[model samples]
Structure formats: structure tokens, C-alpha cells
Target: MADSRSGRSDSDALIRVETLAKRYETAAGTTPPALNGVDLAIQPGEFVAVMGPSGSGKSTFMNILGCLDTPTSGAYYLDGRNVAELSDDELATLRNRLIGFVFQGFNLLKRISVADNVALPLVYAGEGKSERRRRALELLDQVGLAAHADKQPNQLSGGQQQRVAIARALSNHPRLILADEPTGNLDTHTSEEIMDIFTRLNRDQGITVVLVTHEADIAHHAKRLVRFRDGNVVYDGGVKGI
Candidate 1:
């Protein structure tokens, strides 16, 4: 199926998947594929939510889209690069450069200060210490945690911690942000706060934001929803209010 914004130039698309599929081999036998011939496209600056039941292939799809796992068959082109053909090191480099990831768990380093944690990706990118610290502080300010830059993640509330995670995800200035259940650990109030951060980033920076969640309330915040079932897309359309 076509995306809601038809006639989008292919070069402008941020993500493109063609007949993507993944299978797991077990001792019992080759089980049903986790993803079966899926096709999807996402445009830059679009906020899209993916929803599905457990084992519905949504997680697998996210993993593949994030380049943490490769598809067994079919193709995935991210930002015009063919991911299926990239070497392991190339894939890692591409992932680090093009995408930022946020998880349900805040995934913070317990011993590190908030600013240091936000600077971790830049460390891998070989940014100088001064540059890293400056960037980290900037991101902390962006997430409304500039005062907490000196504190550890454990000192913050769940909402504050997730905000830190969002800041860390944006540290590299990635074009796309992939968030998996980023609101799962938060209360309704905190969840709304986190979603607001996501929507703000999407709206202000033109960063493509795609999240996977089971909560309808959470998915509704996105402009479009793509529902998956039995390893295939069941729905792809704009939200009710457009």
C-alpha cells in the first residue's frame, strides 16, 4: 500500500522497505517467518506509529528498520542506501550516523552523570571531550534537564529519566528517531510529556519519528498509524483528525 502522502519523490523518503521478511530457524524446524513480505515507506519529518499484538512482527520490523538485525530476504533502503548489501561494520556505521533509538527502559548508565550519558554516542563518534560536553549540555537544555546535567539518572523521576533518554538519542543529530514503547514505563501524565517532546522534535527539527507501541492512546499522538498482524501490515492510514 502507498503511504498517506502519495507522489512523494523517492529521494525524499527517509525509509523504504520492499518485500521485507525475516525467519528464525529452530531445532524443532523452521518456524513461521517473523516478517513476511512486508512493504512500507516513510517520509522525512513524518510521525508514524506502529501497533501490534505480541509476536505480530512489529518488534522484528522495528529491529530491521533500526539496522540492529538484518532481514533474511527482501530489501530495506534507508535514506537511499541499500542496507541489505552493507557489511557488518558498514551497517553499524550507518546506524550510528542516520538513526537515534529510544527504548521503553531508560537504559541510562547508573554511574555516569546525565550529561555524560547524553554524550556517549559522540564518544563513539570520536568527538573531542570539549565538544562532547558542549553538545551534551545543549541537548540537556533541549530536554529541559540542564539543571540535572550534574546528577545521575537514578536521581531523576521516570519522566525526567525518559527525557534524558530522548536527549541522548538526539545527541548525534540523527535524521530519524526510532522509539520502541518509549512511554511504556511512564504514567499517563508522564507519557503525555514524553510524547510532547517527540512531537516537538518532529515538528521543530523535521526529524522523522517512528515509534512502536501497543497503546492506542499513545499511537493516536502520531499523524499516521500502521498496524501489523501475523507478520504483515493490516492498516496504514492517517489518523481520524488528519
Candidate 2:
């Protein structure tokens, strides 16, 4: 874990990574570095996109940022906290408290109502049923799905299911939203609507968003773009450079 006192220059950055590296031991006496000397800083309320070819380490980077995995070396300060040293259970708790994830697939339970699907994370946090229901309803309304609360996930269209997924991701009021190919399964129009929701969350609620995609058009929706190639960040700059 990277301590706050370790090479942290920007006092206001929500995410700070310096000399971050990850490696895995394979065959005898050989180690492969998934991320080699990666340095990045993401500010509060910023929308950043990570673009890369297959096996370029974008997925590994997202895992580290979301606290799902730890780096082999270097420092990562998330919201001013050094999460690299946290225990597995502590990391899980921190993830639940600070990060919301949106994957390409909605990943909702088939038999549950849209409201119940959105409330699953809250339920994991040990909230009471009534409180969870109230918050779920609030999020559904926020995502324009209050009318579909009673419908099961199977009953919804792809776009509508994604909206429910977005609402569910906001259930805990997370500080960071980690989206991996969030619009991969949607058409252009639906993808735009999803990006609009992400933009609103970042601009209106100050939530930091980190999105991973291979498509240049999808990456353009973000203000900053980080490009990865061959397991390294070849470029990290504004979307204009994409």
C-alpha cells in the first residue's frame, strides 16, 4: 500500500498513483509485469476514459483502482487512503463503501424486481428492508425507472436494464464509479443515454468516473483519456488527443 507521505504531490487529487507496477510469477524464475511503472492522477468529479487493445492492462488497472486487486509495487492513494495494505476483508469493506461498478452485462438477478435488484448492494451493507426499499425507490426515480420498479430484470429491455444497473450502482452513494465497457452491448443511441447518465453523476454529484473501452468514440465522452498498449500507458491526456 502507498502511504500518504510517499511521493504524494497533489493534495486535492482523488486518486494518486506513482510508480505503480504489478507482476505475476509464471514459469521458473520468470515474472511478467502486467502494469509497468504506471503513474496517474484522477481528480474529484472528473470523468476519465481508459482505452487499450486486448491484453494491454486496462482491465488490470481497473481492478487495482477498484480495490479488487493490489499492485506488486508502487503506491496507490485512493481518496487520500492507502488501500494497498488493507486486508482482504477490509478491502471488500472499502470497495463496498467507496466504489460502484458497472459492467457490460447488467448482472441482475433474473427473478428479482428492478427495485430489489438495485437494492442488493444496500442489503449487503446490512441496511434494514424498509430503508433499502426507500433508497432503491429513490435511485430508480433518479434513473427514470420508478415506473418499472415492480418488473423483473427479464421484463426490461437492454437499455432499461442498464438503467436499473446504473441505479443499483448508485445505491451506496459511492465516491467512484468504475465502468468496464459499460455501453459495449448497446446501440449508439442507447450508449449516448448511458453516457449522459454518467456525465450527470460526475457533473452534478461530484462522483469520480473511470471508464474502460476499446472504442474511440466511446472514449470521447470523457474529458480525459488514457491509452494503454502492450501493458503500458502509451498516452494519458485530454480527449482531444484521442
Candidate 3:
């Protein structure tokens, strides 16, 4: 873990990273940094698109931002808390409390009902089964999947499964939703549907969203775009999209 001066800067930004860097150690000692001197600030209610070629460090950036891994050097202040300084256990708790994640693969439990899958996080939080079931059904309704609450994951189409994943992500009522290639596996129409859901969540719920994608059209759905190249951010600006 990084130094905990409890050293922190006063920032109201939902996410603030200063000079972030991550380097991996390999058989040959160490590889080039996965992320190099990255500085970024994302405000609450913002939808950000991260784009880059393979190995451009976008994935690394996402991992760091999601608190799955720490930076080699730099400061990451998420909602005013310095993440780099948190212990592993503290990081897990913070992640469960404040970040919801959705990935390219739906990652739903195949054996469980859609409702149960959506309520899984609540189970970890020790909520009563009845309360979890109630919340899960409510979230399913929000995603227009209440009718499929008892359906098995394999019985649902790709789009619906992704929607379930989104519902599960929202299960914890996290402050930020981090999605990686969420539309990568879907058809164009399905992709749009997924993006529409994200748009609505950001617009109606004011949840900060950061998504990484390889598609330019998909990235355009976001209000802001940040492009990375060779471990450096080559572009950061507003987009014309809503």
C-alpha cells in the first residue's frame, strides 16, 4: 500500500488522480509501466469514456480506478478518500460500499434465479433474505426484467443478461459504476440498448459512470472522452454526445 499520512488533498471531485503510475514485475525484473503519469479528475454525475488500443494502459487505468489494484506511484482520491493508502481489507470494504462493476461477460451465476443473482451483494452485506429478495425484485422491475425474475441466466438473451448484470451492479446502490467493454459482446441493437440503460442511469440517478471501450461509436455515447496511448493519456475533452 502507498503512504497513509493520512496524507490527502481537499477535493470535491468524485474521482481525482494525480500522477498515477503502475508498473508490473516480471521474470526480467520489471516491465515498462502499465500506466505512466496519468492525471485525471471525474466529477459526480459525469459519464466518461475511456478509449485506447490494446496494451495502451486503458485496462490498467480501469483496474486502478476500480481499486482492484494500486498504483506504483500517484494519488487516487475517490470521493475525497485516498484509495492508494487503504489496506487490502479496507479497499475491499470501500469497493463494496461505493463501486459497482459490470464487465464484458455478464458473469451472472448460472444456477441462480435472476432475482437471486441481483440480490447477491446484499447477501454479502448480511441483509435479511426477505429484504434482499424485495430489493432484487425492485431492481429487476427498474430494468424491466421483473417478469424474468425467476428465469435462469441461460434462458435469457444476451441483452437481458447484461441488463441483469446492470441490475446486480446497482444492487449495492454504489456511487460509481465502472463498466469495461459492457457492449463488446452484443449486437449493434443490443449494444444500443445497453448504452441506453447506462445513459438513463447517469441521467436519472446521477451515478458517475466510467466505461472503457474499443468502439468509437460506443464511446461517443458518453459526455466526455479520454483517450490513452502507450500508457499515456493522449486526449481528454468533452464529447458532442449526451
Considering every candidate listed, which one attains the maximal lDDT?
A: 1
Comparing 1 and 2 on lDDT, the stronger one: 1
* lDDT per residue (tens digit) for residues 189-236 in model 3: 999999999999999999999999999889888888888998999988
TM-score of each: 0.96, 0.91, 0.92
Candidate 2, lDDT over the whole model = 0.87
TM-score of 1: 0.96
Q: Residues 116-231, candidate 2: write the lDDT tens digits.
A: 99999998899999999999999999989899999989999898999999899899999899998999999989999999999999899989999999888888888888888866
Reference-based lDDT, each prediction:
0.91, 0.87, 0.89
- The CA lDDT at 143 in model 3 is 89
The C-alpha local distance difference test score for the whole of candidate 3 amounts to 0.89
Task: Report the number of the highest-TM-score candidate.
Answer: 1
lDDT ranking from best candidate downward: 1, 3, 2
The collision pairs in model 2 are none
Candidate 1, residue 196: the lDDT equals 92
| Model 2 stretches with alpha carbons more than 4 Å out | 1-9, 26-31
Query: How many residue pairs clash (N, CA or C atoms closer than 3 angstroms) in each of the candidate models, in the order given?
Result: 0, 0, 0
